[model samples]
Target: MDLDLSSAKLTQKKKNSEGINTQILRSICVKTYRTNITKHHIDVGDARPITLPPYRIWSPKTDYITQGLVHLKEQNIIEPATGPWAAPVTLQPKRDRTMRFCIDYRRLNEVTVRYVYLLPRIEDTLDALHDAEYFSTLDLRSGFWQVELDEESKEKTAFVTHDGLFQFTVMSFGLTNAPATFQRLMNVILSGLKWRCCLVYLDDVIIVSSAFDQHLKDINDV
Candidate 1:
């Protein structure tokens, strides 16, 4: 049977510590499940397709993304949110906006500018991993935003003119060379360790082991 807490009206009525804790856990779990699913079922349908969200399109300019979507549609990786396949058009609100194309890469993925920033070489990182038997990989979610830059670097991130415009709090996806910068940071962190048996990917850690105790040590290091 389906559970409907809304009808129960039992919220905020719990008196004991255990009851309150249970209620809190239940609410948090429900919210996380709903938010991660999609825009439709959680907000509109109470989990029914009959109330699907408005049809939308995503116009990502990057070829890696575009081709991935096309492959997914053909191979049935996931169902499209919309009813049919149609060519994407620019979003002009006055033009009877029915579709939502995912663009506007600036703040969502911050703007970039020309620069000679030093990024650590990937080969050096690979060589440094020659002896370790375990690796613990952790990635800063919004790594670029973690380090502070001078006022000069701030200007490099700004987009453009006519109106006073644009800045970013997080490291955006489309910045020209941000990937290299992130890899560089990873290299730097790994360089300090003497073990030759570690493998670190952005957030995924892979540990190679000839022994059990070493694995625990690797886990502890991370």
Candidate 2:
């Protein structure tokens, strides 16, 4: 009798899973996501661009960095920069024994104005999930790259490398106000459904519902 009951439970779980709309929970396609620009702002008085010397990269990593840059250029995320402002690129080691490309934006961040947008508190976000039975989480792919930078702001993001100077057309990691900008965009896009059935923190989105049907509706709304 117990075995029969367990099998029934498993069958019900499978049925519930089949009701979910997986595509809605996945990141929006890059082409669609990149159509809109999310400009990063700095105080007018503190907007002077900073230029810095290029840092040395290991010889073996040059090929990897070049390939990555080529890929980014092909995708229109970056272009060759010709401006006075420049930052240095630093390749941080990743867990998979690969290098993660990053810009050393310390000097630029120090001089730039700060955004005061408040992120949702962790406790508050968790508390709102009370009684939620059906949950789905979505992560935006290359989240920051989805939002374009303003033309002037793009020049300010110029970075130096062995290849040459380049600037991002879209938002990149390590900018001081990137989190706030991304959060602001998410809040804008998910305005109506947020707090009611969804929670967004940067690139991560969480959807909650008490039933599978309601979960489908919430996912669609997102």
Candidate 3:
């Protein structure tokens, strides 16, 4: 996965010959991407285990679910689970008509301890960009999956599938405190640069600048 922001927009650009240097930006982005592939670890905090029956998926969809679980195991993203917690797996259709493997963690989320780290308010985020002329937005691929779950927290993310029970070693979607955890990680990664040159809301990072040269440098710093 590349770290280059999904899209870089020259919003309301002032006419100038100094356009962005793609080669320099791409080089910096690749370096940043390599540095943070599995940098964040998620701690689910203290919670009692709740074993819930697997949700009934359509009979035809079971095969896809099985394959999905196996794929995750192959990548070491998940492992065989034998813990007290068991959530149900379900398949959601993607825009491309592929199955999106999902785990229903409503019961587990209800009992899990919440993270107090505050997410940035929308108004505040917008306010920070009031004076910016150039903007670049960066998105992390598989944002939640990029973060690993701590050993004790992994079992709490267990999900039952037709093949067997499994738990995600990396943070999975649908956890209650996921947003807070991810936001916290992003904040830490962009501490000094945040608000000064860029703004972060969870996995979405925005680098703002009034000049093109400065914007490129800001992206490098992020």
Q: Rank the candidates by lDDT, best first.
A: 2, 3, 1
Error (Å) of candidate 1 at residue 51 is 41
Candidate 3's TM-score: 0.81
Highest-scoring model, TM-score: 2
Report how far residue 222 has shifted in candidate 2, in Å. Answer: 1.1
Candidate models: Cα lDDT each: 0.37, 0.80, 0.75
Using lDDT, give the best candidate's number.
2
| Per-residue accuracy of model 2 over 1-222 as CA lDDT, tens digit each | 001223333357645554345444333442435736457654435466788897887799887788889889999889999998999888888899898788898888887778899999999998998989877777788888888888768888899888899999988889888999999999998898999999999999999998867877887888
Poorest lDDT segment (10 consecutive residues) of candidate 2: 1-10
* Candidate 2 ranges beyond 4 A from true positions: 1-10, 13-20, 23-32, 35-37, 42-48
lDDT at 95, model 1: 52
Better of 2 and 3 by TM-score: 2
In model 1, the Cα lDDT at residue 54 comes to: 22
What CA RMSD would you report for each candidate?
Answer: 18.9, 5.0, 4.4
TM-score of each: 0.37, 0.88, 0.81
